[model samples]
Target: MREDAESLDIRDVTANWVNAAVLDAQIKERIKSLADLAHTPLFFGRLDYLHDVGAEQAEGAEGESFYIGRRHVHDAQGDPMVIDWRAPVSQPFYQASRKNPLDVRLRRRFGYTSGELTAYEDERLSDPAEAADGEHTSRLLQAEIERPRVGPMRDIVATIQPEQDEIVRSELGGTVCVQGGPGTGKTAVGLHRVAYLLYAHRERLARTGTLVIGPNASFLHYIEQVLPALGELEVKQATVESLVTSDAVPVRGTDPAPTAVVKGDARMAEVLRRALRSHVSPPAEPLMVVRGSRRWRVPAYELEEMVRELLDRDIRYGAARDALPQRIAHAVLVRMEQAGEAPDDRVQDAVARNPAVKAAVKAVWPPVDPAKLVLRLLSDARFLAEHAEGLLTADEQQAVLWAKPPRSVKSAAWSAADAVLIDEANDLVSRTHSLGHVVLDEAQDLSPMQYRAVGRRCSTGSATVLGDLAQGTTPWATTSWEQALLHLGKPEALVEELTAGFRVPREVIAYASRLLPSIAPGLAEVRSVRESPGSLSVREVTTDTGTLAGPVGAADGGTGAHGGTTADAAAAAAGDAAVLDACRQALKHEGSTGLIAADARVPALAAALGAAGMPYLSPGEETTAESRLTLVPASLAKGLEYDYVVLDEPSAIVAGEPDERTGLRRLYVALTRAVSGLAVLHTTPLPAALAGAPTA
Candidate 1:
């Protein structure tokens, strides 16, 4: 059981601290109050969401609000309101990059601060006809208003505390930092602020005039639905990678410049092939098409998913589902990524999402079979045997090595994205740092130097960085507060921190705070200082793969062939059979249990007991992360949280940058993933990193 959880035995409300019924009653009351206020609030103004509460506009579209206008805003005193900063002159969000603002928008989201908004007075944008937007709202009325089909702009609204919002709004400088932990609802609230700012400044930029840069392809699709649900439409959305070269991979100097395009329609075609059948418009869910084109006959609504389907499937060919639509559809954009592709944004995201297509294209072109080449190198122990020298001449070795990208990078949707979201902000970019607006969802994991690297991307010393800095789990490159503040390069006024957490219980704030490490003046005391109601405990599970004695449990007893336990027992059984003896001492859970492991994968003979399965927000699958028997590789599980982690690798390895230490920081990254308990499963003795797992 989680120490912070109010109860462990209850099935319905597994996340709350109290009983399900009791919690539901309280939630119902709260939601009812919100719903009622939504229906007939005394004030008619749309909720003007601050980045937190204090002052300025948030950068992303998700944070933009439905603006009723200056005449509509009311001071706390209930008098007509006005912003004084813009009196003499205003700045515009649109700067040098006007030809393709969406392109620039991608940069801004990732950390590109150069694209400053040239703010303007409100009157300049108010002249459009009401009917031009196809919606009618009387500016004079004080009554609540419902936007075009978009129902409620925001429902599950997680935002920074009021004070933090003030800090974010108040300053606009070269650099800013938001350091916090995972599950803090940083992404959710940041998006809300985007929508809020846009809506509030509707006169400044209409839906068509604005753009929102998001993390990656799947991340965009995962949360993209939020804004449209609130009645907003036509805002441009994309990723930094996509925006830069239209999601095209730039080969520094290629003889024939093989395939410059990695995203867009050509890419979308590959994605669609992988997804659903060729059925476009299902009039029943009719928002996808403004009008169908002669070249394509199927329903337009199917277009986005078509791209998603095709790409997801294609990438799995050593590639990787959208369901009940919310009646909202991704707007069709003309293609601009590939040479022959039209101006279609939807296609851009699709192609970027499917890396398999690019790899396949590269694989097939020039007619060389990677399998053959790989086989040849891998054949007589040349590839498999690490120490064998003179496997081939230096040039030949270089040719074989230069074949393609890492499978992980190829499979990622970053290529076609317009912005980048580094969920584990502290992780590296080596190449990704170039993408604009690198929004680090979890600011807490980052060290000061990483902050500066990300901050520099802004060109304006601006990037959307968020993390709690509580867990000193990993070493940060930046050492002093003076260094952090100096490296950030922005006035202290511009920095912001979010204190509200939508994920953890109020009780959890206390214990989780201990995770943050020491920081310079920048984050000296931004630990988990908030009070919380959650509890904590750790459990130890040990099983020796070599000493199992008999065939009671198979060599690799995991669920692939033995996935027959009830949800609860399957998790426990997996943990029991997989953890290391010494490491077993570290876990302490109260109820259902949270088993933290070096990684999510189970060990040999420790299959049924390992907590494996990557629980992340893939498009249309945010809630799909249930506790399953997943063979998670420790390297990939870094910075994530799970109830249980089965570190089942018989002999987990960590190589340095050159040697096969796996990804350099991967081992450490995986170790810090657990929020509650941790377990290590192995056949032999333990590794050095986990020497402390031994229990009483």
Candidate 2:
């Protein structure tokens, strides 16, 4: 190829790319395409098949070898050097097992350091003696999983487990919901599935596009690189907040928990529907279209009949409104024909746009802006009562109504809950464009209304829903996967569980599992494949030195004002300093360290860390090369991990939550984020769920 390019005439297009000559747009595009192949691995692994099953397949022959990688590559002669992992014949690399080898005899995995292959491992799958365990947990796989911390998340194409591969390669037609424990690779599987779908149906997907929705901006930023690394740079990624209101308007305030819960219910969908349709009023007199010197009139009864027909068809508000004018004009045409006049389609169109006809259409079928409609619903008591009479109780309705309504939708302070409501109203007014596929991560934390908003984007498509039931830590968190699936408009989706964790050690997972029965009783206990015996530790902090005594809480667990108990309250009142020491100690050993505490304790911990000359990053920001310590709020720590985690005051973390169950779930998430070890420093007694367990 180099020789050919060198020998080409200076006027040739190939020479243009090399000489930076002006050329057609197609020539420029080819130049850009060639330039994209400079970096990244060309191939990562190879598969040797037993028979000629893929002989007729493109770039495949009898007993031939295939190199698998993120994307396809070939020589100048068109002979393939690396096959895209999404190709049909590359299935055995991920799905092959002892029970079903898929005619694959040997598999080789290559280790790359800075784009150069440093080592390789070979597994002989055809030999029954060597494949009995059916375990793909090779040393290289472990090394990839435990690779040192770097930047944003990367693709796990080389070490996908058989079970994860099944989910990743599931057919693109149906929805798949995965219940994965911490370190179960659910997020990676979800991203890879999107890449697979785009490859299998590129033309169809390119037309509609795909989306990946995470819980927060930080979580999205952490995974923003996965799809692009897989050669899918066009895939869209956003959080629910950014996808809904940030794209439409700004959200600047917050609502109370009870009000948010009410607004996020699926029942709000019905109320919004009634409120929007209520704007359509009956025509006052009639529709009259004056053309040239003649005038045509359609009676009030006929206009009413036309409106009724459009409304009953269940069409979108804008579509029905636009069609009303044409219907009226069509009626005028019918009258003209009966009166012995010849009128054409152009004549009807002119009549439809007439001033009288447009005024009548405006009166009978008015247009609505979703933001203004939502503001009106929340501000006007009478209007809200009339529309929400049957759907919401009086108390619930009063709770959602704004105390001092803003004068305009633009000036109004919209909360996240209000943003979701606006999205619902927008969908009712006009149809939201559907996508080809959507991957929703940490889905258990979303409200039903949020799910509905996501559902509308993929109504005609499918989804890969991923979350851990026990990690749900919200006031309106879903109680079951079935309920979540139903709300996402994919109730028939297949539900799969992944319990074998590879990141969190066995001791750490078992220590965290004690809270499962109290929080999510229906979920099975998770088991970890990495068994580090001394991974878990608990230290009791004392306040005698007037130092590190964490926050105390009520013993009876009552959280609404009166408090639970005297000692517990006293313990919570006195803040702890031991948490800072633990953070300092954990930073001495390894990769990345997180100082996790309750949302309220964040200020104190940050001050302490800063005073001690430790620079820390929030969970929302990416970890840079200079910083090794991060101060993570419990709320933002759901989908993050670190090498060593320093947890401060379990009781205070629990007290900050609205309820005990949600608090326990948050604690569970915090406890399992460590890849190496965890330290629990508490001034007060541990929660009942973890009180009886061994300390270290």
Candidate 3:
């Protein structure tokens, strides 16, 4: 197959392209695509049919045998050696079963280790004797599920279940929102859907482009390799922050929860519109055009009429401003024509650029920079009141106003919330570019304004919204997927719920689901198929002193010191030691490990890990071959998974959140991140909800 692919002449395809530069780019792209499949398995499954399904077979053809893989592979004669997983013929490989085997008589799955096929398992659908071997199927599935995850996320193309295949193969023209519990493969399904969409609609998607938006840089890094492994690398990936704030200005910090909630509210859209339109005042003077010293004046009434018409048309601010000068010039030309003077196109062009006309146009419809306008509205109380009078309450308006606002827009220290606002203002001034499709992972955590920012980019396209409502940790998180879909501009999109767990063990998932009632009362309990008895462990920090555990350290290399009694300090110290012990135990496992803690405890825990010579990656850094452990803050641990996870103080994680429900939701996310096992160590007593669960 490799020799056949290499022998194909690319020059023959683009024979007319004599330009070396253009040819080089095209050849480079093709080489990259072909080379990507080298590191991945060529094929993982095989399907044998009783008849040649749809193929125009040769005279001597007996039956159709297809090897399913990530991409297509051809022999020297262009005969198929492997079929792309997204191909129509490959559908039965995943959807086929004993009861409804379609045309497949026998199914074979290959076990791969380091891209080498090591073993193969078979399921004979037609033979009753072989069909009774359920143990064989379970063993293969379990081995694949328990495979050590040491680096970035791998594509699960070889093991996609029937349910997952349905969502992945959904049509590309409409949005599909998936409410999946932890370890349910929702994120993987969303990614594979993107790959499938690209394969199914290559030309259309290539013209507008597709995107995958994850929760953070770390989460993005974790799942970044899946699409490329599936032979789809052209998909763009980014966090909401990176996508929305592409302006030159740098974001400085985050807004307070209350302020952010207000800014993120949908009401801010109307307020911004009013504030921007308020810049257009009544035209007090007429626009005069002097074309070659013959002054042709547009009366004040006509200028006001033009402004009113433009405003009423609901066009963009910048668009209206640009058209104002041309409208006035056309009016002046009309007056000249009524006077029996035939003025050509050149006269109107000259009048439009005339200094007098430009000044009058500026006075009536002055150009407004989105950033400058937002800054002015935030800094000036009277202006904010005029625009936000009916939209926001007096106290809410006060909360939204910046205290000691920046002297100018350039010097302003913009927060993440402010960046969304600026994005909204920019779109109001000018249209935002649309894409073909977008996959929004962990969509439940995005604020309304952030959703708006994401929505505009895909306004003309569609989206795959993947998230768990129970995992929402943000202050402005939507209470339901319906509300989230509405904010995403896909209110009518189909909402699919996936509650079966395929990654985390059943014990670990059941332990984590204890928090569901407290955090998300309406959500149905999640169920996992794999039952690993000792997957969950919760140890109380025992200390001789009042402090719960040893000398604690912050994630940033600081002591976990608090002004208290000597006994209290000792217990705190003891609790720190317990956390390290938990980490040490988890490290003994066969796969990647994560030490997750609250934002406040992260610095202390990081210091402890560093002092203990346990090198760990930060939130945005990927785990490397040399290091199998990472220090993750609870806030950024939403979409990340590890083989074994050591959860720090649960009380502290809860305390770090804005409210009790949100805190529990955050804790729920941290708990379900482990793929193999989980050890939750805490000094303080467990949250009331989890107290009834059996301890390790």
lDDT of each: 0.33, 0.82, 0.84
- Per-candidate TM-score against the hidden true structure: 0.37, 0.90, 0.92
User: Alpha carbon lDDT of residue 646, candidate 1?
Assistant: 36
Candidate of highest lDDT: 3
Candidates 1 and 3, the one with greater TM-score: 3
Give per-residue CA lDDT, model 3, range 110-173, as digits (tens): 8877777888888777666655644244466668877888878888898888899999999999
Candidate 1: worst 10 consecutive residues by lDDT?
A: 142-151
Residue by residue across 1-696, what tens digits does model 1's lDDT show?
A: 112232334556456556667765545443332221222212212322222322333221123232222112234454434222111111122121223222111111111112222222221122234224542222221011111111112222212333444333432223345544444445544554444444445454432244445434544554565555333454556543444432232312221112111111122222222122222222332222223342312253554454455444432122222212211222223322222546555554553334433332232222222223222331333342332232334433333232444343223233211111121111111122332223444344334433343444443323444444333223333233334555444435244555544333333333223222222224442233222222232233334332322122232333333344454344445444444332333323221122333332334324433343222221223334342223344433433444333344323333212222222234434433433333444433434433444332
Residue 622 error, candidate 1, Å: 2.9
| Ranking of models by lDDT | 3, 2, 1
Deviation from truth (RMSD, Å), model 3: 3.3
Q: Give the better candidate number (2 or 3) by lDDT.
A: 3
Write candidate 2's Cα lDDT for 1-696 as tens digits. Answer: 334334445464445464545444434433333344333576778888887655445344334688888876677776677888888878788888667778888888888766767889988888899877675666776776776554566788877888988899898899999999888889999999999898888899988989999999888888887776777777888899888885455899899999999999999999999999999998879767787777888999999999889889978898899899889989999989998999999988988888888889888888899998899899999999999988999999999999999998778999999999999888887899999899999999999999999999999999999999899999999989899989899999999999888888888888999999999997887778887777788977664454333353233232211244554434443443466677778878757888888887777666666766878887756547767788888889988888889998788788889999999999999998898889998766799999777774
At residue 488, candidate 2 shows an lDDT of 91
